[model samples]
Target: TKTFVEVQQRLDDVNSKLHETVSGAREIKSFVTELDELEKFDQVNDNYMKANIKVHKLMSLLDPAIVLISNLAIAAVLLVSSYLASIYTGEDKVQLVGNIAAYISYLQQIILSLMLLSMIAMFVSRGEVSARRINLVLRTVINITNPENAIKPGIIGEIEFKNVSFSYNNVNENDDKLTLNNLNFKIPKNSIVGIIGSTGSGKTSLVQLIPRLYDVTSGEVLIDGVNVKEIDLEYLRKNISYVTQEAIIFSGTIDSNIRQGKVDATKEEIEKAAKLAVADEFIEKFEAGYKSPVNQGGANLSGGQKQRLALARALVRKPKILILDDSVSAVDAKSEALIKDNLRTLKDMTVLIIAQKITSIKDADYIIVLNNTGGLDGFGTHEELLETSEVYKEIYNSQLGGYHE
Candidate 1:
């Protein structure tokens, strides 16, 4: 059983690598623009090939071992029968012959049965492992679940973080290290709030809490004065639209992907969302237009095109709160400006933009500057932050080619 488990693990690893090699072959080919990259690809392929060979060798050895054991059993049976026949004589020998014939048949049946049992044992071992894996997943308990008396919020656009702190590891909550430290801020209804910080400063982590993706370890995340944890999970997420940093496109038509945001969205609504996201410009260029096929992960489209399509999907939702987590990084300056301009037209909806570019959030109604320690450095308009926050001033100067009077 232990040997079977080890072999099964190796087989799974090899299969995973084989799948990656096949699926990412085109990407690897495109990325092999230099000698070093080509060499790396070759090295990875070689390692996978070697591992595959080892597994095959182990499996090949099993057949010979089984055959050899069967041969030895037959030889032993023949030797014993020959000795018994040699010791018998006349009528007793005749009777012994008949008995030996029946015994030989029984011996053959036993050997055949043993071989079948061996095959069954191998399969049963593998099946047991697979069953255990499935059972583990099925038995897993979800940490985040709605309470018994969950409440649905009346209005969800307004968001507040009250002395909230979060740690990825809940086992040791008292540890000084945390992903987000005592964050206290309020975003009013119908406001455009921009969050900017250096990498690993918890920009994405902060916005994720708004949608109740993760519950705060300490303090509370409130939506319209109600603790987010107390609200129904489905109700909270339904009113919020979150566009992640990575533009994840599915294998379907452009229209189908956009319609995922709102299943019952009309044709006009889809087109309007596309236009607002600036996706219609390129989408119209295709002969199929809205019906154009999009490959899995949007591999056929450019980075900017995929980002715009993702933005269109979010826009179609028309949620009360929209969170864009570095969603415009792939877009050019002109297109980014246009998208921001269109976002301003969305009334009665709170928009939160997490961006690396200062220009992306400079004109936002409120700007939040987070330091590297997961704490707020400053919170105000771009102009106010520039005067009050040295961090904001440094970011502004770096991006805008130095400060001006």
Candidate 2:
């Protein structure tokens, strides 16, 4: 009990501090999960402490009260036998001594039996209480709302966000405040739009809502003219392929990683996708070629190689809407340019590229520039935005001296 309580307290303290430091909602959730687990351990310790106290009290009564009374009874008999022996000096004295000795031996046996029974009772009580505690923890309820009256989204690639607002609890309104507020946007079918934002401008949050990672607090996100909340989650997600900024490549060969998207993809299709993503050159460099084993998260691979491999994985899915959430940020300028060029060749595909650098999205059909605050400061093509948007001019001047062709 002591050890468990100490460990629980330590974990809670450390995770609480971590919760304060981490800004991302995902990281905050992980810290909260850790805190919850520690609280459960603390509850178990509480139950164990209560049981230990009860057992201690019972032991005290068995040792002091019952043993003391038995010892007093034995002492009184010894005194009486000694007095009788002094009064009568014969075989009667011997018989009296034998009876006293037998009585003392019987008393010892009774005392030992009582101690044994008391110990058994204490252990049984502890067991029963521990069982109840474990059962309570197992039966504890978690708060997760269920979906109601949801419909299938079909294969439509339409996406829209209307008057969306979101806020987390216990954060400062003046400093680290609301991420997105009253935001409105639409992604038209077969249109390639790019979302550019400074750090913490809710870029990830905005795209995350398309897949309903989080429901908007007070507005609606619609897919194919149907509210996302009304659509079946599985059906909606199957049509969208999202490659995140963090390229996650599991420990496997190049072929295995690409085949992850479509398990039934043929060797020819896999090779074709790799070529399109510019991953073929690097794969061939390895001695084992396509069969070379990749380490966890592709740790051994270069940054550009990982990005290209992730692109291959996403391409193999042949999704209706491709959402690249800063997926090409790690690759070189030339490699990113190749991927961008390849994106243009995808027929009937709706692509959304979220990037940091302006060069990454210069050729995009439309670029939406987000300010440090949660608001859209500009939205247009590279040429139009440069001519009209102040933020775009500043970005252009800050990076490439001017928006030169």
Among these predicted structures, which one has the highest lDDT? 1
Clash pairs, model 1 backbone: none
Candidate 2: segments with Cα more than 4 A from true spot: 1-3, 9-146, 170-176
Q: Distance from true position, residue 65, model 1, in Å? A: 6.2
* 54-133 per-residue lDDT for model 1 (tens digits): 64676567666766776776677678878978998788878876776786677667767766776677688768877887
Score every model by TM-score: 0.87, 0.68
Candidate 1: minimum summed lDDT over ten consecutive residues — where?
Answer: 32-41
lDDT of 2 by residue, 50-139 (tens): 655654665677778878988898999888888888998688877887899899999999989888887777666556656666888999
Model 2 pairs in collision: none
Q: What RMSD does model 1 have? A: 3.2
